[model samples]
Target: MVIKSSMRRSVRILLVGDRGVGKTSLILSLVSEEFPEDVPSKAEEITIPADVTPEQVPTHIVDYSAAEQSEESLCEEMQRAHVICVVYSVDDEDTLDRVTTRWLPLVRDCCSDCRVPVILVGNKVDLVDYSTIDAVYAIMEDFPEVESCIECSAKTLKNISEMFYYAQKAVLHPTLPLYVIDQQDLTEGCKKALKRIFKICDVDNDGILNDAELNAFQRLCFNAPLQPQVLEDVKAVVQRNCPDGIAADGITLTGFLFLHCLFIQRGRNETTWTVLRKFGYNDSLQMSRDYLHPSIRIPAGCTTELSHKGHQFVSSLFERYDKDKDGALSPKEIDNLFSSCPAPLWGPDFHRTVTTNAHGWITLNGFICQWVLVTLLDLSRALEYFAYLGYNTSEKDNQLSAIQVTREKRLDLAKKQSSRNVYQCHVIGPQNSGKSMFCRSFIGHTLEKTFAPELAGNPQCTVNVVQVYGQEKYLVLRDIDVRNVSDPLLPAEVQCDVACLVYDVSNPKSFEYSARIYLKYFVESKIPVLIVANKNDQEEVSQEYLLQPSDFCSRHKLPPPHPFSASNKIKRDVFVKLATMAAFPRFHAAWILFYKTRHMKQLGFLRGDSVVWWKAGLGLAAATAIGLFVVKVLKTDKS
Candidate 1:
């Protein structure tokens, strides 16, 4: 049998097991109408349709006759296989033992990333007894790598097709990618091309691909001539980013766009998880405690820096692999490296190339120059690794909990950084705690330096609400006197962007008072805050006096107190920079919105506030915005 790309999509199915376990018979029965009694003299390929619920996949079943060959050769075959079928005879218990002891190890060694799916098949079940079958089924459950176990008979054609079906499903819809693709240098053309393919493939014009359309589109665009049986391979990609059922086909437009981007594209598109796993990240998402943390150890920040000084790192890496100090990687050493549980950062193609070039002996130069992939630390690159690390194949949650958690943290950071304009900084502290002096530093005192040095000896308590203008575009500092210990924080009414909590470190009572107030009001406020430990330059201020506020901050889960000396220009300058950074995101967000609407204004579509009012319901939005602002300011001043 010869496999053809005539179907909508194709899945590569490789059969592996101990010799004489009916592996050849299984392939022959599924693809051909008649069974051959004698062994075929050469390799054969069979094309058959496997129904994969809502879609049919055209499978390429290769009857592997070289199972008894050298392990290196066996690995080459495993490298090409998308899904592996581990075959054993139900009548022969020893064949099953060979599966756990022999075949599984070779399969794992060959398929390093563990991306390929495996099906445990007990073949020739037609000749087996019930008790024997039951015992085999019980044993199959113990192997986590074996996705599903089934009894089949090639002669009777019992579950032969079903066994192949499982293989296709494993390839198209495995729990996670074998290697995460992090496209650091992704081009606009590549992204646009992928998008165009998805749109073109949605031939039905309904904005999504059904089973037939997806297969046709994949064939036309990627030139992946997979039949309907394996076209369901796109289902996993489709359903991943697709929305709720559209057009009875679950595949969404966005999902189609990213299908190849996530799975096939190498380089920047690859993930950190796969890269680290190659370097040996355990199944528990941990490394040896002795190993340096990835954030620090991996030369992720400067790939160019690593590339420039890479020879030294390469020498160190090669020393680990080149056993016996031969200055070369032998076939057995390469096999041992590949056979390790963690998947290779580079996949089978790289392995094959290395083996082919050195004639099965990898020179140290070849190992480093070709095989070692440098990890880059970038948001897109890191996210790809997180997607794989957070993945749980057994549970089909939204991209996995770990990915979601990481995404939220990154998004929050992005949101805070983007919208920096119009931010409010509420300066809270005990009376006479230099909160007013701190606010003054942002305005005229820093620029004009008008504050008298003598006034430092007799600091005035904040009497009324004082507002100091920061850079007009960035922020406004609101100095409120929180003298009344019983006053409510008004956190719900006043949504401040930054909370500047000041305390005089020279005065222990002020430090204690600030901590009490923070614990009472701001602990659960969900506001980004800075603890200002003031009077840091005072000669009498002891180490603990300055450090005590940090302790309070730590206990309250707040950021470490920023040591400040009002008279010190350097510390004041740092405070100014921090304030600017906190407020810059809002300013940037407004600037972006203004430019984004320039085209609308050029088209004379600027309808102003009334249009927004009408569209967003003027009564509710206007009332709420105004009400909140007034209530917050008034309540804050009163408190």
Candidate 2:
């Protein structure tokens, strides 16, 4: 069946360059498969049918004439375009110069927030006996967000199809560049090209991509299945860096971006260099002693620039080793660190040199100077050291209770002085339990009874998790169908803070499994679960498996089962209120503060080491007791 026009895929491509730069010629070549001797100098748009895509994708190409350079009209076109191609002729040096000086700035100004993908095209390669294509490609690398720079001949049809293919790829599967150059490094002509790309690959629109989404993306991009070996390698890198691990379903947006980088970087299977680079190590395995520090000992043949994060990482690592805070690592501390290092032996001579420098203790400067040489010689050992620093299979794969994991995350957020307001609530139930309708109504979708006949069919088509964002309370609702519980990419039961156990009040079997199976086996006590008895508006509500609030509260030891009817306003309001309170961030934050404060009070002296230590210690103790009382009450109710 033919897909609806609203669902038909399309991309608007804007062709821009200097006058007589083959912009019109190239368009004619792509559409008609022939080059016109006389190119019209009028601005026009043509829609070409792109049957190469999975469905028939309509591609609109706009050949922009230099005469229509009005600011108002240009901005309007740029806003509409999905991808912008800045064309330059290989034979014309002046036209290539205009690409950097004129075309790039205009594109960036109109599409900075829009984030429209850009391609730098060098056309008319057949005209030149020899070409400086490599030099142009190298120059294009300096331009940020230039997806790919390619030279194609419109007359010879060499790489012409490939050029438009890349244009489509840029629109369909755009990703941020792995490296970003500082603006100060570019000249005035190239100033507009320095804006970096933001890499967010949520192709499934679920706020995150799981294994299934990732696999789908691979198939769409490559027209082939992802190799099993490549999949494992990608997972290995993510497990090393992401604290949530594979069991957290897939990875976050940041993890997805890093995975994309790993795909492009050299040595695909080995992520040692990727790990070190992530933790502030430059390409040469060296960092400044401090952030923006003037004192930098740059080694020869080193191209890695100074990173601010690298300085912070080194300073924090050094502080951990230098407990005395004397600005150096003692022999005992060095030995202890080496014990955990992935490398078994540093060699007798190398160890002696690193341990005893000109100073009695090893300083940051001395440590970096020696480590650079070792990395240049034996890179394998450096990878081991990175693994020891927490990016390893052993540490990432280790299981932790939901409570402990949440507490650690809260502490990290506290350290960063921020709070996350968005919360994820997983909705689950057995087949035909009105779970989908409950989710639809909760997200404010209209629940007209006229559609009840359509909704009564077996609802097991949810192959991928469906996410709905709520307008109120800033909550995210994820519908994890019961059939997808075994899917590795779907979020685990423990990953969510709130459990929504939906069931049909008309179906006795639904209620039985909602309580005995889902509640008993899947939902954890730490998670606040709300049992929703749906379809209360039905004529015959089965009382055989249904119990009143007081009876159910006492029997299952859970909060009252919410008798929900999407059509009834009163029931809907009550259920929404209960769900909001359970998923609210403030409630979770309060518990986090209580637990962290209790732990801090035990430490006692981390607050200060002054004459008023006793006063400070006593004040903390008093606050801890109060928090403990509050926590105890809350714990008793399992809120």
Candidate 3:
């Protein structure tokens, strides 16, 4: 079990009952190993070291007597006590009668806000040959805080240590939180917590804990694997008791919860408590903050991303949930994937934000990309879901191992190449400039398929995998909404790995909006800029500005305006260009020259025995080679 730092360091047990119930003798007997003949009205506080206790927690024993301590003092000790021991003489009926009538009521009155567990200690049992266990059990049902009833004789040292052990156990692993005596079943809170654990252990989402998953869960909680025979024996026990508990030769959720309830019923509350604490649950059955959000520091200019281990784990999880053997996860499969979480982290808008298949199902690539997006944008939330999704292993103690902080962006720029696999591009344009369609097209959605009425009002962000120089990289396109020409872009909106300024070729005024946005945001920034003329299939009109799109891009030393038409087939090369620009921000001019030369060759402008075209292509290729050489020399000199 993992002990939280927030838990109490010591267990305080206060003995409160009628004065002649041998409470003082019980304390002295455990300390000196012998009952004192001349006992005082009250014994001084006794402390037990942690090493000597079964719970490995320091214990403080307090004795209460009406002759030595005032009522206020008794109430103060009662309030401070972690667990209260209600001592009663087995031979004396009046002492047992006052247990429910006086001492138990006083404990409730003093600590009304917080329920403290109580152990009913029947001291001086040697004085009577009869047993009062039945009478004590009746009173226990009335006061739910009472954990257990044990009879021991202080004079004979009978259960002298056992009584204190039970007292300590009551405070450390109390049964009140896990079980209810009246209903003979687990409490609602305990059931809910165990259900979550059951869901997490059911790795295949089949609603059953197979042999492999059960052993894995065993190793996780107990630090040791279970024997084959022992596993079968446990299943047998659950099957004999509850008929519906076993299913498909494995333990169902009903069986899982039944085992925990059985543990609490058989005075084995520590078993359930151990499982709960190992899974980051506290005494109240709520997930602790430290476990949900472990401490992770990201220095200035650095971003967070999933490590290789994180990617592997999430990939395996997706495969486990993809029951249909398809490449994507349906809505039901997605729901099962996040069933262990408190609520679904991704909402209806998630489909519109990430790359989806033709059926609008989230693909494996899209699933990983979404995690990457969350890790970069909101790390705390990612850590929270990491905990929720059971992202833990024996090799790693916390979620920190699943995440990695990238190097400073400035360092990547200084190196002229980024080692990062994900890049963000803000697609800034006017409302009618095909901004939304442009962003969606990056994820393989064409203009005809973009009119989804269900996803109309969703956030304008789409992520997809792109190949940049034979390396797979994720490119995130965020459509920046500009209400009017006078509306200025926020600093957050302006910041990105690359800026894509889109304009409608058919709209005369659309180019002016793109121009003004670029001049205002990208002119003085180090971020690479790409100008795109959307709606190229329509009739092109001259822009109502001082310069056309092509001339403006050239004047600003930006990439030439690339024509795009989502009305026809969507070209993926444009996205590749954007990702390449973002990957090597400092080598933009070289990349532009290199791509231009490659485009000329791909279009066969230098082929077909055309001397003029061949000469032009040769001149462009030589110039591109020289530009790349100069950029390389400058980079080497700087390094």
Candidate 4:
């Protein structure tokens, strides 16, 4: 889907068209491969997001049926609606005519508040000649209201995304990069990717993540996903360091911090460092630091021959008229200096149409484009240099092996931060120490649906962790009821990576029980555990049931218990960290189940729902031995 840059969330697009035109078949062919001939009229929610930055427009599409009026409900589905695409098969000229006359006015009236971005889609264009497609594009230009036009065949899946891209540009901001994902619709692959992304962002290791976690996760995947300044949470490093402003100077320490957050939010994942290495930072941190600072003063004397060379080779300035002028091309000439080797200057495949002739002398558009390329190269260079520093690079290109995992500690740290392991985490907190509350808090308020007044006040209504799309991360939650812990519907033999045993600080009894159940019954030797003391908001947490992190960790025989409040208005980042702290127990349990009952099931790595015995019998045996030893030691010598 085409979206304005820095859209944190995916867009949902609805495609409405006639049946034989292969509406369902088209969307499915590009996104989901299994397209049955007979598609029942239904509305499916699709999320397609590309380009991420605060204040950037994110395109959303919702595809539906035109024939089945009730089925076409994108108007009610996608909020703050942008574009509505009216799909028609080029093979059927009749449907095309109907779109301009009927569908156009219908959609316009339906979404009267904003001018809906309309894409007059000509589907099944693969069968038509190239000129025929061009005619369709031209015909669309006549529709003054029509933002853009494109011909795509859903059957052969030709340029399907380009159609959506044009539609998104009409209503949303135009400057954003058009994210042409193979398929932006909700599909098996998208779901899988969502799962992976969720796992990476849930840094605190909880089954879910909050807003801070979500933002951080995005930062980890792609740097500059959105404009950094708009992101309130990610403060500018320079802002912090240079509050007074460095209008005439290089970047300060504070600027780096903002950049740091940008990197985490939008940096290259496993290979971000690799991207930085390509841009001349080399292997020296000192040199990289210097470029960031720009130590050399601006030339006062451009007449010098050495200054002239610097301008040509480094700045790419004034080769045009500066025959005698060298590195010291006048600042005015520097503006158009990059025309010499526009394509090859960046090595290869620069794809930038902007050049010396770009955007008046400033060539703002071209400059921005070049900056993006240079940034990518810089990232490549920095990443490569960092990798080499971590691992020995013996090649001329000095390439570091792009191995996801490595034996070295630095690489391991990088992997942990960049690539997260997807695991089933269990929340094992006490009766009301806020286990359920923590889950809700972790998901956050943005995604929570408000209930009708009747249902809101009704008792016995609760949102269980069956499976939820987390606000910050996407995860499947399984809330093990108190009675169902030992025999969870999931599986009797399954063990989870963590069992986040929680206790309410206000209620001492519940806290005690939660701790015991987490250590003795729920966890085995193979499984690790984390204890959490939820309800920090309550006065009793500190005044009555006081416990330090170290004390709690020692008492539970687990990692220090994270104490926090899960009431409404939670700090998203802090909450996510607490959840991750609780993830240990769940991870341990998952592994135990996998080892103990290996043959129970093996769902595909990407999509798995079968029972896994993460809790191994061998683990239980080891725990039993330790228990027996303790009993023997406690026995009185009454014989």
lDDT of each: 0.51, 0.52, 0.84, 0.41
Please give the clash total of every predicted structure, in order.
36, 0, 0, 88
- Model 2 compared with the native: what TM-score? 0.34
Q: Which portions of model 3 miss their true places by more than 4 Å?
A: 1-6, 452-456, 595-639
Tell me the alpha-carbon RMSD of every candidate.
Answer: 25.4, 26.9, 4.9, 27.1
Per-residue alpha-carbon lDDT of candidate 4 for residues 454-534, written as tens digits (9 for 90 to 100): 212112111111111131211222344564334433442235433556677777466656645654565444444556667
Cα TM-score of candidate 1:
0.32
Q: Rank the candidates by lDDT, best first.
A: 3, 2, 1, 4
lDDT of 3 at 383: 90
Q: TM-score of each candidate?
A: 0.32, 0.34, 0.90, 0.26
- Give the candidates in order of TM-score, highest first: 3, 2, 1, 4
Q: Compare candidates 2 and 3 on TM-score and give the better one.
A: 3
Candidate 2 per-residue lDDT over residues 1-639, each given as its tens digit: 110111226978888888877888888887778877777885468887767543257888887875866778878888788788888988888888887788787877887766666888989888888776666656556666676668898888888888887776666544332233342122221111111011112333334566666665555434465687777777778879665545456666556545544543332312332333323233223321221122223243221211223334344455655666677777776765554343433443332233233445666653542443333333444333433442222122211100010223344233321122234467777787767666555433346632655344333111111221232222335566555334333335445546777778777566666665454554444455667767778853454556643355445445456667776453344344334434332243232222233233323334434434455446645644554455568668974
lDDT winner between candidates 3 and 4:
3
lDDT per residue for candidate 3 within 259-328, as digits (tens), equals 9999998899999988998888887778889889998789987878888778887898889889998999
Give the C-alpha lDDT of model 2.
0.52
Q: Report the Cα lDDT for residue 604, model 3.
A: 22
Give lDDT for model 1: 0.51
